[model samples]
Target chain A: MEAQKVLTPSKREQQKEARRNAIINAGYQEFALQGFTATKLDDVAVRAGIGKGTIYLYFDSKETLFQEVIRKNLFPIRDEAQSYAAEFKGTATEHLTSHFRRMYQALHQDRMPELVQLVMGEGLRFPEIADFFFREIISSNQELIQGIIKKGVEDGEFRESFNAEFTQILIAPAMVSALWRLQLEKQSPLDIEAYADAHIEFILRGLKA
Target chain B: MEAQKVLTPSKREQQKEARRNAIINAGYQEFALQGFTATKLDDVAVRAGIGKGTIYLYFDSKETLFQEVIRKNLFPIRDEAQSYAAEFKGTATEHLTSHFRRMYQALHQDRMPELVQLVMGEGLRFPEIADFFFREIISSNQELIQGIIKKGVEDGEFRESFNAEFTQILIAPAMVSALWRLQLEKQSPLDIEAYADAHIEFILRGLKA
Candidate 1:
C-alpha cells in the first residue's frame, strides 16, 4: 500500500530519469574503453544493468546516446568555468590565467581528454557529433575568452588595438597541448604546466596596456 | 649489345631510383584518396606501373612506403621555409610573420594537411609512424622556430624576457588552423588567411620590444 502511494506519475518520471542517467554513465565508460565504432548498445545495457529494450526506450540510437554523453558529461565543465569566472574579482590577466589552469586541470583529471581524442580522430566520419561539439564546446569557450579580452580592453588593462575575433589565438595553445598529450606525448612529452604558464606570459605581454 | 650496355650496374642503379620515386608518388596519391588503413599495395603498384612483387622489393611494408612518402615529399618544404628565413633580413616580427605565412601556404596548398590528418587520426594505432612524424617533423619544426626566437631575443628585436622554450605557443595557431580546415571547416569554416593575420598581429605585439 505504501509502495503504491509512492509510485505516482511524478515518481515514475523520477525513475525514468534515474534509468536514463545510469545508461549515460555506462555509455561514457564503454565509449572511453573501446571508442565509438566498437561500442555496442547491448554492452552498454549490460553495463548499466538495464534491459536492452529499456535502453532503446530511453535512447533511440547509439548516436543519440553518445550525444547525450557529450551534453550531460562534458558540457557542464563549461558551466562550471563560467560560474567561476563570474564570481572572481581580479585583473583580466589573473582571471585568464586561472581560468586556463582550471581548464588544464579538468582536461587532465577527467574523461575530457578521451572525448577530445574521439572528436579529433573520428569526428570527420560523424559530422553531426563534431558539429555539436564545436557549437556546444569550442565556440562557447571562444566566446568566453573573447568576452574577457573585451573587458580587459575596456578597462585599459589590455591594449586598445587588441582584436577579440582572434580569440582562437588565446585558445590554440591549450587545444594543441591537449591534443599533443593525447596523441604524441609518449614519444615527446611536454611539461604542460610550463607550457601553459609560458602561453599566459606571452599573451599578457601582447595585451598589457 | 645496346640493351646489355643499358643494363650495366650504374644504369640499373638509376633505374632503381626512378622506380622508387614512381612508387612513392603513387603511394602518396593512393593514401590521400583512401587514407592509410584502407590503402593497399596492389593499387599502389597499379598506379606506379610496377608489379606487386616489386612494391615489396622496394618497401617491406605499407607503413615503410608511407614514411618514405613523408620524407621525400614533405621534409623538403621545411628546408625551403628554413632557407627563406635564413636569407631574409628584417625585423623579428617580419621574419616570423613571413615564415608563418609561407607555412600556412605550404600547409594548405601542399600535402602537409593530409599528412597531418593521417598522423593525428591514425597515429595512436601506428606508433612507429607517429614516432617518425614527431621526431622528424614536429620536433624539427619546433627547434627551427626556437632558434628563430632565440635569434630575435639576442638581436633585441623581441623582449629579453621572452621565453623561447614555449615554441609550441608560436606554432599552435598554424597547426590548429590547418586541422580545423581539414576536419571541421564544413561545419565551422574559418577564413585562415584572416586568422593567420590576426595570429601574427597578436604574437608580434606581444613580442615587440
Candidate 2:
C-alpha cells in the first residue's frame, strides 16, 4: 500500500469550516421547513451528514445554531447593502430603485423570505429569538432604509414629510411580496419583477418633492 | 316533584345557534394558538364547553370547522367592505382613507390578524385551507381594492398607469402592520393609528394624478 499523506493544519481548519457551514445550511432548511420550535437537531445532523454530537462542537444548542444560521446567511447581505448605500452617489430615487432591484433579485436566490416567514410565524412564541432577530436584522434594515430616505428628504429629492418612521410603509410592498411568494404563490401567482417595478414607481411618485 | 316546562322551538333553535357559535369561537382560539396541524378537536371541545361529538354535530370535520370559523369571523367584514365600496361616493383617495380607517379599527377589535398569521404560517402546508382562504377572502378582497383602483384610474383621481394589478402594493402596509402586531410587538411597539395614517398618506401621494 502507498504511504498515507499527512494533513496540514490549514487543511484541517478548512475541513472544520466546511462542517460548520454544512450544519448552518442544514439548520436553515430544517428551520424553514419545520419552524424554530419544531426543528430537530438530530434531523439537522442527518441532513448535514454528521453525527448529532458533532453539531455541539460548532453550536452549543439549537437556538445558537439558529442564530448562527441567521447571522451567516442574512447579515452578509445586509452588510453588502449597507456598504452599497454608503458608496452610492445618485438621486434618492435612483438609490431606492437600485436597492429594491437588488432586494427583488436577492429574494429569488437567497432564502430570506423563508426566514421572514419563520420569524413571523414563530417569533412571538419564542421572544428570545424574536429579540435577537429584531436587534440584528429588522432594526438594522430599518435604519438602512431610513438613512436613504432621510438623505432623499434633505436633498429635496423626496417630500419633506417623509421620514424614517415611514420606513416600514416604504418597505411594506416587498414584505407583502415575500409573504405572498411563500404562502399564496400556488393559489395566486405573483410576478415578482413586475411587482417590484410597480413598487419603485409608486414610491418614487409618492415621495416626489 | 315540580312539573317540567317544555322549551319552545325558537328557544331550542337559539340554543343550537349559540352552541355552533361557541364551537366556531373555540376553534378560532385554538387554531390561532396551536396552528392548524397541532390543534386538536378535543381541546377545542374543552374550550367550547361541549362534548367532542357536539363539534361533529355542528361541523363534519376539523377542516370543515376551520372553514366555518374563517367564514363566520372574516367573511362579514369583507362583505361589509364590498358593500361600502359599491355605494361609496367620493374621490378614490377619500374612499381609500375611509376603507383603511375601518380596517385599522377592525384590526384592534377583531381576531383577523391572528387568522392572517395562522394562514401565512400553516397555509402552505395545508393547501386545501389555503385554497379556501384565497377563494373566500383574498380573491374577494383583491377584487374590492382593484375595483376602487380601477375607478380611480378612470376618474382621473389617480395616475393613468395606476391600475388594478397594483392593488397588492396599495394595501401592503396594512398587511405589514398586521404582521408586526402579531410577531414583533413586544420587542418593538408600534403605534398602529399613526402607522395607518402614514400608509394612507403614502399611498394617496403615490397614486396622485
Per-residue accuracy of model 2 over B1-209 as CA lDDT, tens digit each: 12333344466777999999999999999988777767999999999998999998889898889878878888888888889988999987788789878877766666778887777776655678778888887788788777777778888898777656767787778877887887788878898988888888888888778
TM-score of each: 0.82, 0.88
Which ranges in model 1 have alpha carbons more than 4 Å from their true place? A2-30, A33-35, A38-62, B1-30, B33-62, B85-91
- Candidate 1 lDDT over B127-201, as tens digits, reads 787787788777778777777777788888887776776777888888778778876788677898789888888
Best by lDDT: 2
lDDT of 2 at A104: 78
Best by TM-score: 2
lDDT tens digits, residue span A60-149, model 1: 888889889878877789899878878989988788888888877877766777776666666555778778877888888887888788
RMSD (Å) of each candidate, 1 decimal: 4.0, 4.2
- Residue B126 CA error for candidate 1 (Å)? 2.1
* lDDT tens per residue, model 2, A1-209: 13333344466787998999999999999998888767899999999999999999998888889888877887888888889988999988889889988877766666778887777776545678778787887888888778888888989898787656767887878877887887788887898878898898888887888
Error of 2 at B172 (Å): 1.1
C-alpha lDDT score of every prediction, in listed order: 0.79, 0.81
